[model samples]
Target: MSNSDPVLLIETVRPDDGRTESFWVALVITGVLLLGGLGILLRQEQTSATDTRPQLDLLQRQFLMELTIAADEIRFITTMNSEVSTDTGFVNWPLEQLLQEQLLPVFPGQSAKAWQQLEPGCLLLPQPASRIHFGLVLQQAGSSIHYAPADVPLPDHCETLLSWQRMDIQS
Candidate 1:
């Protein structure tokens, strides 16, 4: 009976099919893809931000020119009106539509809007949703014409092209 006693042991065995290596490779690939996507997203954001500057410059130039034209026209009209006693019908028309026609081709996806329904003196700049409404400011500063952003606290001796009445009150 003692001789009949026997010991038995069981051991677990794993097959070497390179599964661990495969898992590591897959993890590395996923990480690289994620990083590449993140980098691309960041670059796109940078490019878009840079692109806005050129459009902004063009808008500013056009806005300033229009302001100069308006001021000269108004000053001339004022002189003419002083000489006459009756109201001239020329001063009542809104100027936004005419300006927009010339500027539409230069800047896409933006429409010129009046600063106020009753007044045709100013305009609010069109910008993307993430951006604020920057008012185009133009003024005659001595011999030189001054142009600046209306939202700026002190706009370097420039008068706003558009009135603040039409901008969102919360902004």
Candidate 2:
């Protein structure tokens, strides 16, 4: 064989095994799965955020119940004491007096503000929960809990109490 002669070595071309197509399919599937996972995560976060309102509503109800039970207990005690004069003005016991007497339980981050007596039989107290503003209303018959907006002031009179939405309290 001559040194510079053109080599005639046979070259075989391998048939296509569809590796490139398989890689593309895998890539597309992985991308879709990643995007789906991201969408699911976002939806869950949104749901969790919205879930807070009901939880806050529950908290407000609990606080109102606590205040109502304490007030009722104090009223019962006051009524049992026959020697003490049953003054109409003294019927709605002040929150300070209740706390001072250890009749009312102090919750975390509670405001030092006193409970307001809207009228002779109506008493309202503000809730201290940070997320939502609420008021607990005590009347002669049954007590009601109310949700107050942060921008609007609390009801100064029983007439204004109608403007607030009454929350459902179970028992």
Candidate 3:
């Protein structure tokens, strides 16, 4: 053989085996399918998360609005009762008006009652009634809890009360 002979340096190319080629193709296809499935799962989770955020925001806003209205109703009732108690030594007209107008609309199944216990008087003199009592009877029917008198309080003569209560709902 000569040093420069082309036949001495020639390299033959062999065909791939069917089993090996099929194994490699299956592996690549399985890997691609797994990656695609994972990608779809991740995208679905992200979309669900994105959709839930706005719904949560809307629920929070609704709760806040309801709380505000409840606070306003409480304030109006208390202030009207206090005023009438101080003026007439009994809460009669204001209590009736408040119950008929404001309280009925806001708290549908609730009723407001005022009581006056007069002081003991001598034979010729009348004792001044010093205290007035206002009570609210509420019948709550839905999932929401009624705002109690303790739950709603005036803020330094302010007409509104701001408070937060956490609620959980199963989806």
| Strongest candidate by TM-score | 2
Deviating ranges (above 4 Å) for candidate 2: 1-61, 78-90, 104-107, 112-114, 127-131, 168-171
Model 2 whole-model lDDT (C-alpha atoms): 0.59
lDDT tens digits, residue span 30-142, model 3: 99999999998888734343432222245334543554454355445545555333433332333345445643232222233321112110000011121111122211111
Give me candidate 2's TM-score against the actual structure: 0.43
* Model 3 pairs in collision: none
Instruction: Give the clash total for candidate 2.
Output: 0
Cα TM-score of candidate 1: 0.27
Q: For model 2, where is the 10-residue window of minimal lDDT?
A: 82-91
RMSD of each: 14.5, 10.2, 15.1
Better of 2 and 3 by lDDT: 2
List the candidates' TM-scores in order. 0.27, 0.43, 0.25
Candidate 1: where are CA atoms >4 Å away?
A: 1-56, 83-113, 116-171
Native-referenced Cα lDDT, model 1: 0.42
lDDT of each: 0.42, 0.59, 0.34
Per-residue error at 10 for model 1, in Å? 99
| Model 2, residue 66: C-alpha shift (Å) | 1.9
Candidate ranking (lDDT, best to worst): 2, 1, 3
Residue-wise C-alpha lDDT for candidate 1, range 70-146, written one tens digit per residue: 54554355355542224422233244543543431213455544232223323334345324344432212111223
Instruction: Between candidates 2 and 3, name the one with more favorable TM-score.
Output: 2
